[model samples]
Target chain A: MTALLQVEQLEVVYQRAITAVQGISLVVQPNQIVALLGTNGAGKSTTLRAISGFLGLDDARVTEGAVRFKGERIETLSPQDITRRGIVLVPERDKVFPNLTVAENLIANAPRGMTLAERRRLHELVHQYFPKLAELKGREAGYLSGGERQMLAIAGAIVCGPALLLVDELSLGLAPVAVEELTRRLVEIRRELGIAILLVEQSAAVALEIADHGYVLENGRVVLDGDGPRLKSHPDIQEFYLGGSGERRSYRTVKQYRRSRRWYG
Target chain B: MQLYVNIAVLASIYALIACGYVLIYRVSRVLNLAHGELMMLGSYLLLTTASLFTGHPYLAFAAAALLALVVGALVYLFLLRRMTGEMVLAAVLTTVALGILLRGVMVLIWSASQQYPREALGWANPAIALPGGARISTFALLLILSTAAVYLSLFVFLRFSRWGIRMRAAGQNPLLAAQRGISLHGVYALAWGLSTFTGGLAGMLLAMDSGLDGTMVVIGLKAFPAALVGGLDSLVGALLGSLIIAAAEIFLIHHVDPLLSDVVPFLVLIAMLVIRPWGLLGTKEELDRV
Candidate 1:
């Protein structure tokens, strides 16, 4: 089976100097939910932006590697062109047009050449997944709670009729309950639409709960990758990411200890 | 009554031109400082078309208007489009340079002589006497009506239309708009096109009312103060700002020295800046962005 997206040895450099992502690679098969887990500045968002064609905005470029969407080379395409090709991103910050109402935000994102009936159907599909958005249709997106904004961002992306959805920091600044609800909704959206999702997340637990496959990134490289259940049982993931160990250790001892990362060849 | 009529006419002219500034600035956050020159270009196009069309004044006028829209969009496509993702100041400076270049080009093409588009189009600007003995020229009345129509249509477009909402979305957050598949270049081009179209209409009408000359550029410059005073992003603010600026200019010209006419709008602008830098209806956060 062909992958929806393939990033082969991707390296992104900012302003032709600082390397943000150093030859990291990952893939998402059609209709699969793939999680890219990393902490702040681990090049997770940079990788996502590289795939989404937003590198140019930050004076960054794909120095070495290619981003392929459904067997087509799309590394040099513009954001709009990339989106038109059916990959939509729900950005981490300033995700929604704040001044626009919820309905206007959704209306603002119809893919090129979409008919009115298709638009209405997509709108209904979005509202069906995020019913709270239907109630907040008249409210300015700026006034929405953190979770509602995320929902609207996703809904807006959905309206674009994307084959792949890139979600950056899905659970950022949201309550646990809200995050769980959103994750469930994301699963439902994926199940119904049969669309692939490349989810960038810092919370491994949240990502692994819904992710079909997961990759752990550290210092701009993929340290480990596996199917969901196997990744969940990995000791390094539990120790560093999930905080599974209960026994208290001295600060000095903990600071001195370093766990060897099992790098994937 | 005559004072009120004069105020209304001047206010309408400023409002029409000021909305051009508001439209471009609101969308791309770059002030098209070349707006006045572009406005003058529209009048000149009308002059050429008038002679070309010969007996058909309406055709000449429509041709000029359509040409202005195309020119506006082309300006974005060829010139301003390159400035995207660059610093906002650089884009604004590009417009400034464009204005100077356009001014020079217009002089070479049309010569320095004042040209009457009204005469070229074979139309008479007869003043219509009002009930209170105030007279308004035919084009000036048209200017008032056109301003109202443009503003009403723009308000409706921005509020209810899908493309209009997309424009607003693009203005507020260009990155997200692009992520959502709305083209930034397309939105910016539309803004430039609409802005130039309206500015061109004001120029065409003003030239018909009063002969077109280099001084028309000053009128365009004067409208900038109106847009700034109302908040550069708000159309309603542009209307209110134009009224305030026109009222100040007309009343000061009547009550004070006539020489104060050119300085009055700038004075109002300075006062507005000192008192409320964001303008009356403009978003408070926009001041920092500027």
Candidate 2:
């Protein structure tokens, strides 16, 4: 299958200091859930942001490489331009328009210039995916729970009907039940809408559980990239992730590991 | 009745200018201290337009609006675009620079002498008598119509249009708006263009009210009181606040003490800041930002 999105040797630098994501390369196949996992500030977010064209103190001025979305060079495109090309990114920090109502937030940055009926129909699909948002359609987004805000932020991006959806984190500060529900809906969105997804997650277990293909990022490079289950059992992965040298300690019996698994479950 | 009529007339003019300031501030978040200078530039645009040296009156008015539009675009690109500051003080200072540039240009074009746009076309200046026994000039009628036209179209465009949605979203959350694929540059450019157009309308209306003069630039300051009273976040607030400000200004002049006239609007501003803080209809979230 052709890669839906591909980044080759992409490098992002801040001033004289290079947060060198040295020679990192990755591919997101069509309709696949690709997870990027790493420790805090592991350059996983840098790569995602570079791909998304988020122009802040950071941007997509690759020191030496390219990012292609749907076979087009999207490296230096504006965030808005990237969205128009059918790749929408929901950044970290639940960046919802807190003052806008949920329904308004969903439609605020919607694909502009569509017919009214078409826009409304699209709104319906978004509401269908996140019923919690629909229930609070008229309420200010700032009042939403953290999980709900995350869900609404995702809904806002996905409603654009993108070919690929990039999510920063879906389970941060969320209840386990809610996380499971969100993961289920994301899976539903993939299967039901055939949208490819690229996710940046801190939780290796949660990401692998839902992902088809996964990559582990360390510092600023892809340390591991392959099938989820294969990487899950890899020795270095087990050491770095599964608490080095501990044998098959099932999370159900281990309360210490359970803290890392699920909050409610 | 005459006093009430004057109040209404003044309010309408205030609304026209207030809308301009609101738009520029919303997207750029810059006070556009030069906003008054834009108003000054609009008067010049109208003066040159009315001179026509040749064309008809309606043609002149249209021409003036078009010229103001260009001036507005240039201001955004050259003067206001690269302006970024640690706090708003930097942006406000840039606006001050823009204001100085415009005033200098105004003197360059029209000289330091006071002037008014020529009433080349006979369309305005015709007379009308109100049922309240107040005689209103046809110019007042035109001012009322133009103000309504601009405000009504703006209301509809913002409330129901796509660009308006994008513009409003930019004001609410520029970072998130950018994430959704709304070009931040495009948003800023559009705001400047639309708001500058309002400045022209306000200039034309104020010219119609009395006459275009250097002092006429003060209309921008007058709009501040109007905008603040209406809640800077709201387009409707501009109009509502203008009416309140204008009525008070006119009444203070007519009833209480004429010397207290200029003081009235600021007093209202102090009262609102003390009392509602959200103006009449501005949202709590917006007030928090202020």
Best by DockQ: 1
Structural RMSD, model 1: 1.5
Candidate 2: stretches off by over 4 Å? A18-22, A58-65, A70-73, A110-124, A131-139, A234-265, B53-55, B84-88, B112-118, B124-127, B267-290
Q: Tell me how many residue pairs clash in candidate 2.
A: 1
RMSD (CA, Å), each prediction: 1.5, 5.1
**Which pairs in model 1 have colliding backbones?**
none
Candidate 2 interface RMSD, angstroms, 1 decimal: 2.4
Query: Lowest-scoring 10 consecutive residues by lDDT in candidate 1 chain A?
Result: A256-265
Two-chain DockQ for each candidate model: 0.89, 0.48
* Model 2, span A57-137: residue lDDT tens: 453356778999878898877777888888888878847977667877876775755677876776888788887787898
Estimate, for each residue in A24-90, the C-alpha lDDT of model 1 and write its tens digit.
8899999999999977898999999999999998899999999999999999999999999999999
State residue A181's C-alpha deviation in candidate 1, in Å: 0.8
Please, what is the TM-score per model? 0.97, 0.85
- lDDT values for all models: 0.93, 0.78
> Which candidate tops TM-score?
1
